[model samples]
Target: MRKNSIKNTRVNVEVQHELANLIREGIKDPRIHPMTSVTAVEVAPDLKTCRAYISVMGNEEAKNNTIVGLKSAEGYIRRQLAKNINLRNTPEIRFILDESIEYGVAMSKLIDEVTGKEEVQEDGENNQ
Candidate 1:
């Protein structure tokens, strides 16, 4: 099957959703932060491998620990995945730390700072 085919897209979405659910409620590892989220999932067309992008809302240590926890739980996650979703072959999950959400938040803060400074300047000028 083609990588971007409809079937592949559906598989990706389903895997992503199930992964998020599993991480949020199935796992009991303390290393995995409660603020963790599955940002995206990419399953190979052959359904032999998968990349799960995970985002954690905390320090570097928390992110690292979350990945480690997820990696250790791969087998269990896969089994759960197979039971939950009827796929031809349950993909082997590779946990990847995704910093896009953090980056976006930082960028937003910078923008707000810049805009706030401009607003302050405008207000000061108006008061003169």
Candidate 2:
């Protein structure tokens, strides 16, 4: 199958949904933060491997610990995926720490600061 086939897209979405559920409810590890979420899932066309991007809403320590916990529980997660989805081969999940969300938030804050300063300067010029 092609890399960007319709079937592949469906598989990616299904895997992402299942992974989010598994991480949120199936795993009992304390290191996995409650605010953790599956940001994206990319399944190989051959279905031999998968990359699961995870986002954690916490400190650096929490993000690191969450990735470690997920990596340790990969086997169980793969087994669960096999049982839940009728895929030809259960992909080996590689947990990836995604900082895109945090980066976006930081960028937003910077924009606001810049805009705020511009507005203040405009007001000062008008007053002068």
Candidate 3:
């Protein structure tokens, strides 16, 4: 099968959606923060494994704890997916902490700071 075949793409989207809902409404792990979200999922071409990218909105400790919780619940999650999804074999899922959101937020804040400084400099120059 092609790397980006239509079947693989559909599977990826469906798995991502189901997993997001499961995390949002079904999980009861305390280590998982309330702001955790399934940002993306990449399913293998062979459909044997899935890499779930999760974004946790919290400090480093909270993120680590959330990963731990997810890892521990991987089996249960897979079984739940098997029951909910129509896939032949529910792929083994691995949770990865995605920090892109945090990085983007940091970049935005930095940009804002730079712009504020530039505005201050412009005002000072105009008043001179």
The candidate scoring highest on lDDT is 2
| TM per candidate | 0.93, 0.96, 0.93
User: Which 10-residue span in candidate 2 carries the lowest summed lDDT?
Assistant: 1-10
Error of 1 at 74 (Å): 0.5
lDDT of 3 by residue, 74-117 (tens): 88889889999998778999899999989999999999999999
Q: How high is the lDDT of residue 70 in model 2?
A: 95
Judge candidate 3 against the unseen true structure and give its global Cα lDDT, from 0 to 1. 0.91
For candidate 2, give the lDDT of residue 6: 96
Model 2: residue 21 alpha-carbon error in angstroms: 0.3
Clash count, predicted structure 3:
0
Query: Which prediction has the highest TM-score against the true structure?
Result: 2
Q: Which runs in model 1 stand beyond 4 Å of their true positions? A: 1-3
For candidate 1, write residues 1-128 as lDDT tens digits.
Answer: 44488999999999999999999999999999999999999999999999999999999999899999999999999999999999999999999999998899999999999999999999999999
Instruction: Note the residue pairs that clash in candidate 3.
Output: none
